[model samples]
Target: METSQALLIYNMASVEKCPETLTAVNASSKQLNCSIDTYGNNQYMCLPNAEKSSLVEFCYNGIMGIQVEGNCLEAKDGRVILHSCKKFLSGCPKKPFFNYDFYKYPACQHINLKHFCYESDPSCQALENSGGFNNVSNDNRDIMYGLIGGLLVLVILTIVIAGFINERRWKRWWWSFTGVGNEPDRKPDKTSGTTTNPGL
Candidate 1:
């Protein structure tokens, strides 16, 4: 997909993740910064590490009917930290402490981790391999230039033809008005043997 298309998908997914409440603060190649304030004091920012995480999560959850977690939530080095997920979780116990700071990898480990997605995400790879994003084919460019050139030539030809027709019309009108070539030929009268005005 093209960058604009991918960004559109990403934005759509971000909206769907929160549905009319998400706001994108900044979007760049390195990260997508977004925030949600609908949940009162529970306001939070969703920054996915990979460029296509929003698109991937949207496809996975909305289209594939699979539950995708840790997409918009925060993480460190592609691993979802406990504190980050806890903010969104409700009625969860806090007494039982775990040694590990990050949650265990999900079954779809490849998709859940941001680093893995960045490196080997199928959608992004397909988009890149298809030469659709940020890449233009030479043939398409050449065709565009050819069409422009043809149109320019057509315009010039039409102007030239119009000018030629106008020039001919002007010459005919000037000749008629000035009597430059419409004067009757004078001839000597044989009987009189001299040229003479009939009126005189």
Candidate 2:
């Protein structure tokens, strides 16, 4: 019997803390929307209705496909290999999880890790590999082009038809005003005993 390969997974954990490192903070409080300090850490002093400062900590963990030396985690070929054991940790609020200077260890500098992992999932990977999104985008582009082309053709046709109608109307008005087409030839004025030349 053949054994199946183990599928790698990514996981994230988060915790909120108050001024005291060991004390837990309420996540549902409206005052959590405080401003961050210059160092990118949350300013506990800005928390409204708060008696003390607070911070949030996030930890990441998972298994790496390959072994790495030292404390470095592998982020090769856009894959993150978690080297650290899954452990609950604390850190300053507003700081990123991968900031080595603030919260040490298991650090890899892949920005947007959550998005990368989501795309790497088997279902999403299949769609991407098969050009699902690409196909949709292409289809949308084609539809837009077709609509623009059709509108341009309609506008041109309208302009041509309008010009034709205006030209006919102008000809009719000019003929009526000048009496050019239906004028009768002048006849002799018998009562005055005078005859006018037809050419004149």
Candidate 3:
């Protein structure tokens, strides 16, 4: 695909980290209002239902994807759903999972990953091809920058050339206005062997 087409796809992945508010659905099908809280490890957590949950802590680790406990969440329609494994049954069951709505997150519109949660989803397939666009976008950006630089150089050259031409014209005008260097060539007349004045 062309770089422009790939850029559109790549831009879709660049999302905002925070928004005015966030909404989520818990395992109980209860709608929860979540808030963002940043920590020291370049990680952040979501506090659900206006308070903290002891059993379920939704945190986003910058390295991978969003996670609750240790399990990765599946992204869909700008939201992430956590499918708990059997071992974490005490915290979250396999039946109904915890879903966090990151639709309001401006930096990243969507998150896609191949994990325990809905691995067969189409978004997961997109993740497999996401790597190709990065390099393509970088090359395109470099080309764009080069084009801008070349235009700047052309503008400078144009200004320099215009200045040189204008300076010559201005000097000629000034000399004529002041009647300087307007004298005719004072050559001797061949027949008379003497200089002749045109005014005489």
Candidate 4:
């Protein structure tokens, strides 16, 4: 009889200092309504005091999936619940958990972690053998920059060539307009009118 080997799975462990929630957006005006530039992606608007200065910082990785641990979330009324996911944040949870509607529910059920599980923002499985498009995106950006640089160099060369041609044309035009000793190979033409001015 053939038997199947069980798959090994690991739970990711993370340390959360503060159980603060977050809202996300760009623009300083909106950030003021939300919070500070923590992620710097300008993706998340923050909630006031939602983040702890020391312990709230979390580093999650794709290797083991994810898990979160932080101070118990305390509601304004003083009820506490385990703060594991983004729901406990001052802002909306963007993931497996909640949204702005969560705030509408009574505080009695606000602290639930069942909704959040570590997930690939884009299905990681789709990019599995595709050379990690996220990583490749950076290389593509570099290639674009190089192409732009090459184009700029070409433009400068074209401008320089055009200017050189224009300079020669201008010199020819100036000689034709003013009739200055422009003939390098011909001698001056003279007529005998006893003193006829050749310039006339």
The candidate with the higher lDDT, 3 or 4, is: 3
Of 1 and 2, which scores higher on lDDT? 1
Please, what are the lDDT tens digits per residue for candidate 3 over residues 112-156? 222212223344445555656464677798998899999999999
Best by TM-score: 1
The residue ranges of model 2 lying beyond 4 angstroms of the native Cα positions read 1-136, 181-200
Clashes of each: 0, 0, 7, 11
Q: What value does the lDDT take at residue 151 in candidate 3? A: 100
Better of 1 and 2 by TM-score: 1
Q: Which predicted model would earn the best lDDT?
A: 3
RMSD of 1: 16.8
Runs of candidate 3 with Cα error greater than 4 angstroms are 1-136, 182-200
The global Cα lDDT (0 to 1) of model 1 is 0.35
Q: Compose the digit string of candidate 4's lDDT tens values, residues 30-83.
A: 523332233332212111112212111111111211112222222111111223
Global CA lDDT of candidate 4, please?
0.32
Candidate 1 regions exceeding 4 Å error are 1-48, 51-71, 74-76, 81-136, 181-200
Q: What tens-digit string does per-residue lDDT give for candidate 1 at 26-125?
A: 2221143323223321122233334324422221011111112332222334332222223322322234422111122221122323233432335535
TM-score of 1: 0.32
> Can you write out model 2's per-residue Cα lDDT over 1-200, one digit (the tens) per residue?
11111322122112332222212222322234433334443322101011112222322222212232222232222233332212212111222243222223212221122233222235434545676445567779899889999999999999999999997787768767996652334455689855465897
Given candidate 4, what's the lDDT at residue 120?
Answer: 22
Better of 1 and 3 by lDDT: 3
